[model samples]
Target: MKSEYLRITGGTPLEGTVRAAGAKNAITKLLV
Candidate 1:
């Protein structure tokens, strides 16, 4: 079986507070 990815491709502004498990800083660094 194959895996699929959740992709968001478009020109727009995403505004909101996204909370996840663990440190928030870690998530930001991962994005960078």
Candidate 2:
């Protein structure tokens, strides 16, 4: 299956707490 990727350009320093929730059976892989 094809997968989507993400790219980030110039941006101010990020601050504050970040949180994420993932699926129990999710597949994770690194592209490039």
User: Which one wins on TM-score?
Assistant: 1
Per residue, candidate 2 scores C-alpha lDDT tens digits across 1-32 of: 95543343466664563232452123222211
How many clashes does each candidate structure show, in the order listed? 0, 0
Cα RMSD of predicted structure 2 = 9.3
- The TM-score, computed over Cα atoms with residue i paired to residue i, of candidate 1 is 0.32
Candidate 1 deviation (Cα RMSD)? 10.0
Task: Kindly report which residue stretches of model 2 are placed more than 4 angstroms away from their true locations once superposed.
Answer: 1-8, 22-32
Error (Å) of candidate 1 at residue 12 is: 12
Q: In order, what is each prediction's RMSD in angstroms?
A: 10.0, 9.3
lDDT of 2 at 32: 19
